[model samples]
Target: MLKERLYYIDSYCKTFTTRVVKESLDNMGNWNVVLENTAFYPTGGGQPHDMGLLNGIQVTNVEEIDGEIYHTVAERLDPTGEVEGVIDWGRRFDHMQQHAGQHILTAAFVELFGFPTVSFHLGKELCSIDIDVEDVSAEQLEAAESLANEIVLRNLPIETKWVTETELDQYSLRKNVAVTDEIRLVIIPEYDYNGCGGTHPSSTGQVSAIKILSTEKQKRKVRVYFACGGRVLQQLQRKNYFLAEASQQLSAPEDSVNTAITKLLETNRTLEKALDEAREALLSFEAKDLLLNKERGIVKAVFKGRTVKELQKLARLLVAEADDVIVLLVAETEDRLQFVAARGAAVEMSMKQVSASALLAINGKGGGNDAFVQGGGERTMAGEELMNKMLVSFNLDI
Candidate 1:
């Protein structure tokens, strides 16, 4: 037997009494009860299921399977007598406003530019409709939004009616109906006429307002994001809060916040460039001092808290100053050790030999050509010990 859909009869019906025809455990082991008549709307047509209490047991989900509407509840109930079901009005009305807003906005797009809405989704806080176009301009969005709100302000009646396939020709439809039997059409008078199975408000004014938040390209179409009714107010409140916080932190008025932020970023970039130049000058002075203490045309030094890049820069500066100099530098940090080996253009020894011996002593990995090599690994051995191992491999007298 087909259950009477009380929601279709009266979308405003929040509470109803219905007899439970059957009760069983669903595939996921949840209790599902089928009622002889129900006001709860099932999840379908991009709209979510209605949720509320069914005889005090919370109805978690409602779905239609094989033409029967099953209400999934927290606990099992007797399949013998009637049960009282209540709909969450807040959620129901929010959906109504958004769904209706979509219809109005969709019609506005078609009426203004012949853009057809191919799909729609009613999300928790926002709603979207994908149009059959590659792109939509900001001006088009503004025009559509303006026209949609005008319809809402006019408060046109929203009507729904069941029609047969043969009777569908009496009025022009925005799109073809998907179902042949029990064809339901939601009409906004001479403006929008389309087949839909989701719940909506009785009139356009109930939507309160419609705002197109943004749009993005999806494949060959454009998806428009929007919010309606109470959601619009919530979005405005959230954005205002963020702007207020930014203004206070920047010590600027709301209207001048953008200018202040841009100026701050520019100042930061200038300071960073100056710091880099100063650090490079200091490294060059230190490299010259180290060259003065060289022994046997080889310079060796150990330092703390220096990066491998800095060590490489210092070694390069040392070799550039003397034609016969070879530099070996090690930097130690809390958890690791880094070293650089570089030789002047006139030096005969390959720095690769130094890196190979140093890497083996610390169980590290590094690579370079005949003149320069650098590497770092876990601080398994003391930096001085590793440097002594490399010197031995070099067969240097020092």
Candidate 2:
């Protein structure tokens, strides 16, 4: 026998008693029970399923398969007995408000600008409608929102009718009905009429309000994000909380918070630029001192806690300051060693030869061209031992 859908007859039906048709265990080891008649709306049409209780057992999920509504419960139910099912009224009502609000907003766009809604999605915290348009302007969104809320305030009756395919021509539908056998049309007087299988409230006034939060371009179309009824208030509360926290942290009033943040960012940029210039000057002075103390055309130095980038900069500065100098610099960190080798333009020997020989002693890997080479590996040997190895590659007595 076909399971009677009590939700279609009355969306407000929270509780109903029905005979248990079958009982089975799903793949996930959850118990699924089917009832002869169900008030729970199964997951369909971009709307989630209704969750509640069936015979005092928690109904975790509700889905329809092959014309059968299976209610997944926390516990098993007797296969041949009657069971009382209760719908979670709060979740059901929230879905009703959001679904109805979408119809009104979609109609408003079509009525004013001839833009049709291509698709709709009802999320947990927000709802979205994709329109068949390249872009949606702020003015257009405001106008649509205003018209939708106006319809809600008018409290127009929301009517649903079941009709045959031939009778569909009697009414002006916003879009073509997908099913021909049992077409269900949701109508708001002459304003909007569309075939939908989702649940909705009895009147538009129950939606409370409709707010368009934002919009973004999706390919060639535009997606409009919005919230209705309690969701609108919830979004507002969350935004207000963030604003309050920002105001306190910035030590500025809510109205002046943006100005304060802009000023702080500008000040930070200026400070960063000055600090970079000062560091560069210090490195230049250190390079000149190293050149003055060079021995036999080679400048060698070991640094603690210096980064590879800093070593590269210092080596470049030292070689640029002198015409006949070869610079070797090593930095020792907690567990690894880093080294850089650079030679002045007048030097004929390639730094590649030096790095190749020194890298072997440290069991490290590095790469650079002939004139300048850099690499680091394990700190198996001390910094001085690595430097001595580089000198041996040059056949220099150190």
Candidate 3:
């Protein structure tokens, strides 16, 4: 016979003595031990497996295969004697809290609205449930969350019962039970009754609290992220830490941070607009200076520590402002070279030909028409050298 899962008998049981029924090395060279009976819950029902030790050997994983629970151990142990199994209570209880909180929250959504949970996942740090709804509103989420907390405050009894498939119709199930022969129902009397095999605390108060962190649209469903029990406190601590840092950096109290941020953003926008006007004025002056230095309808210049975007903008301004002119500009960054070539509407030379010829100097790639072309590549050659190469293609002196 397979080992009786003691978790079903007592969800709070942390330690038990069970005989090692069989032991074998898995393909990964880890020992997989079967026991006569066990308290360690296997990985199922969207909850992770219990982890701790078996006979002082670390139990890293637990899985159910063919009705037999196999405990994956870190080291090989004696295949024949009685072994002491001890579960990590903190991990197990946290899972129980989260799983139970999921039940309460899911029930609340179904009760307040017609939304049903299409799927659920109990993660290590957080839990999420996908609702069979296109979207969820803040008001709906708050209402469901409030009701869940209310149930927790009431400390309602969380009852569990085993019944055959024929006996399931007596209670109103939240959804259809997955198993027919041996159905385990987790019930909060007059509140929720659902088929579940996962372990839970004896009462709703153990869940402590449920805080919905965020919601996102997934396909035709709404996936809600939430934290429960100790996770709620953990989330609060993390957010408070961030809030404190923000308050200090903004030089404002928590209450005034929002207003301060809004004002700061408005001021930043004004400063940006002024800076844009200044940049345009500077570019206009630079274009005039370059036109004076223009040689045979071609203007070439190289800049250090500038972005390709700035170089392109300057080249565009130069060609647009002057008729019968061509502009070749290069900006040297820390690790690469960027260049722009452009011709005015009156100029007949192809910017693409100039760019393609100059790109060979730096092993670069670019594409454009006769009006404008841009590219960037390795800093093998100085920006000035690259610009000179483009000038050579146009048969103009640099």
Candidate 4:
């Protein structure tokens, strides 16, 4: 039988009494560590270790290296003093809520959909559980979530048992794992039964609520991120506050606020779509005019005070439709200028030639091709002048 003392003592552990198992000197010979029989939770499973005191020496970190627990302290204690272990129960229980909530949520996946909770991670900022599944339909996930909350409401008790290798076989367990002679099984009543060594709540009802925040594909499985208990309460409060603020700003009632916002968004989308089509038509007309009105049978475009790719697309479209076959367009953002060139024999304009006259004339920089070349010039009020200068390099006047 394992002789190690259980810090969780059949309930929530706040303080503990333990003998100093051993003392060791570090490689640097500067810090000393005291291993003890019991300890607060350590920085494992991505959750931070408890920080309080071991015999008033100010414990910095506690780690379970091997099968023993070592408490790292800031200052050395008198070797003879009794090691009294105190934990930050508030933080410990906060993590308990999260871990326990994970069980409730994951079990719901199994109880409702027969999906197994493949792996789990309790991160510092959040916790996630992975389940093997090809497609997680939103409706199915929602139903699973509803069942999870019902378990929370029912508040089924949470229990842990130390079972032996032979006893493990008696349960018809889910697959199998490489565990020690004594395995700790976290039982979720009729919902789940899995081996875990992490701290958790006394009952599922203590979780109060749960939310499957999001799910992401993890190889052959799906990782679900969730929050529960006190954290869920905090999340709801923050969400309600934002909704109330939105309702006030939009001058809508709380119950109808959702419908009102949806309608408003649809209306805005329609208007924006119509406006975009109109703008494209106008751009097309101007592009056609540019090709026809060219003095040297070359069409060029230069837009100033904006950095957008739309002008490039317009230029390509124009070149495709026109016959003489040269399309050049450039735009300048606050930080830099860029240009795109297309069409017949555009590569003749070298960078130096384009920079010296074409782009240099407009004071912006960029050039490329026998069919297309780009260069950058300094910012100036006249961008069309740069295009004109570039055409000059090709021995064409416009």
Candidate 5:
């Protein structure tokens, strides 16, 4: 016979005495305790299991399998005697508020718009519902949130009743029941009627309030993030802390934080653009100087702690100004080496061949067309030494 689930009979019961019928080890080697009557709710219907103490031993987890609710514990209790079962009321009530709030908010969405909730997840910090819609707007979310809070304010009674599959036709269910044998319907008078096995509070007011945190498009549906009951206050405090820190860092008042940040970002962008232009001008002058000092028709240069991008820009500038020049540059960081090889329009050298041969010195990898090639690898030698080695491989006089 199936043990009576005391949680279904009284969701508000925090403490109860139940007889331990069986004790065994699960597949994972965890101790499982089965009770004749249990107040603990198992993990089901997207809601987590209730954690509590059984005969003073901590119950870590609870799961239902084949009509049996197994309470995972660390130690075994006397199977022949009754044990005191005390659930963590705070955690249980928090989950109840979130679960009930979901019902009201979901009902509000269906009543206001035509969105149907597809899935739900009650997370540690926040809860979310996936709606069967392509998109959800801010105004729509606000309207639903307002309506849900109105229901909570009205203190509408949240009732649960057991029904069979045949009796389901008497109620307008928001979703199909998962079980046909013993279906439990959670109803909110004329507002909501849905098949649910999860425990809920006695009234909607116990949910306190509902706040829509954010929403995003997920596949063909929309996932809406929200917080109910105590979670709403927690989210508010976290956001307020962030805003306060940002305002302090920006040296702006709370009311003007947004304006101050916008102006600061604009100023930063302007400065970045000006700095980029200055850097480009400096690179052009350096390219000209290197060209003036070129040995024959080739310009070879080595730099310390320079980037591959800078080397590419310098090489491009040099080749653009002189058509008969070949540019080979190497940059050396702490333990890495980078090089770029390019030929001017009038020069007809195979840069790919030169790059392949040079890469052998440092076991590097890179690719490009004949006119321009860039690569990087481990620094086996100094930047000047690597550059000389590349010139020798290219068979060019430096």
Candidate 6:
């Protein structure tokens, strides 16, 4: 078959109609149609397919299989008839926005840190690029991101060129060229020259903004995730919308809202602390009423379905007061049971066994070490029954 002239050769060529040469569906249910010639760029180089229309049907995907490129249409077209393929300018331009930003950002990393991007994955959420480097500190990440934004602000001219291996011997490629034989290099003027098969914008100035979302350490590699162009602007627009609403409700400017909230939070924290201290003092007085009578020699305390924090705090208080110190704390939240027991050399208590029994009763799981025992079983039993079972099994005075 004669090779079709790739209309994408002219990245600026967005509108073109071509005859559908062949179409088939793979086992994965993706449609593959080879055109006589196509302006639609297939999924490649961390960029998505250039989606558009095929004879008025929406073209959702374009892919390559076994060196043959295919365009997936929304509806089945007459394989025998000539079908017109048109590129969706809105979608194509959005992809270009992200692609161009990525090139500039990736180039900035190499230029500033001497580390090159090993691979890039573009997705709807965020575009991620893995760099060849150890774990990058937050500050180091900030620096790279800062540099990328600086380039974005600079809006340097971006240019694309196709050069033969022999002719390009004088200039250095960004990384190892997989196939230097016939390479299409996307150039950012004085910034970068990388072998890229994806379509790109005419210049960097088209990418209005770039934002670094976050970075995570994946194994030994550092992955930097970011958003670019339209996505960045979209996020800012949403943020501003919320800010405006908040500013109106709070009677403040968007800039001072965060600072104002921070101050309010600090003041609230002081008041909350004072209230907590007063409550604790009152709780200590009421806790004396929960004192267990020493008969056969068991120190116990009764508790309602409370938080572990409250129970633990009471246990510590009782442990300090008891001479023959064996303290068992009980709390149940919702349907779950929690038990905290601690003995300070005054009694022998296996924490693991206690945790086990409590878990079995509640149809859950828990464990602890020596000097502390805790058990929780199903919440099938009410507060009274649950407390009674623990007292009988653990041989404690309720």
Please identify model 3 stretches exceeding 4 Å from their true place: 1-3, 21-31, 65-68, 354-367, 377-397
User: lDDT of candidate 5 vs native?
Assistant: 0.91
lDDT of each: 0.91, 0.91, 0.90, 0.70, 0.91, 0.73
Tens digits of lDDT, candidate 4, 240-287? 999999899889988888998999999999999999999788878888
| TM-score for candidate 6, residues paired by index | 0.78
What is residue 7's positional error in candidate 4, in angstroms? 3.3
For model 2, give the RMSD to the true fold. Answer: 5.0
TM-score for each of the candidates: 0.74, 0.77, 0.87, 0.73, 0.86, 0.78
Indicate whether candidate 1 or candidate 6 has the larger TM-score.
6
RMSD of each: 5.5, 5.0, 3.0, 5.6, 3.2, 4.2
What is the Å distance of residue 367 in model 4 from its true position? Answer: 12
The candidate that wins on TM-score is: 3
**Model 4 worst lDDT window (10 residues):** 344-353
| Residue pairs clashing, model 2 | 364-377, 366-375
What are the per-residue Cα lDDT tens digits for candidate 3 across 10-85?
A: 9999999979888899888899988888999999988999999998889999999998889999999887767998
Q: Please, what are the lDDT tens digits per residue for candidate 5 over residues 289-385?
A: 9988999888988898888999999999999999899999999889999999999999887798779877888899998999999998888888888
Q: Candidate 3 versus the native: TM-score?
A: 0.87
Residue pair clashes in candidate 3 = none
Flag the better candidate by TM-score, 1 or 5. Answer: 5
lDDT of 5 at 344: 95
As for candidate 5, its clashing pairs are none
What tens digits encode model 6's per-residue C-alpha lDDT throughout 1-398?
A: 21234544666676776677787877878676887787887888889888878878888887787767777776778777666767788777778888888888888888877888988888875798999888777777778778878877777777766677876775677886776566667777677888887777777768877888888887778898888888897777887899999888778888899987888789999999999999799768645654555434444555666776776677666656664566666675666767776655666655455556556667865555776655555666665555565566666645
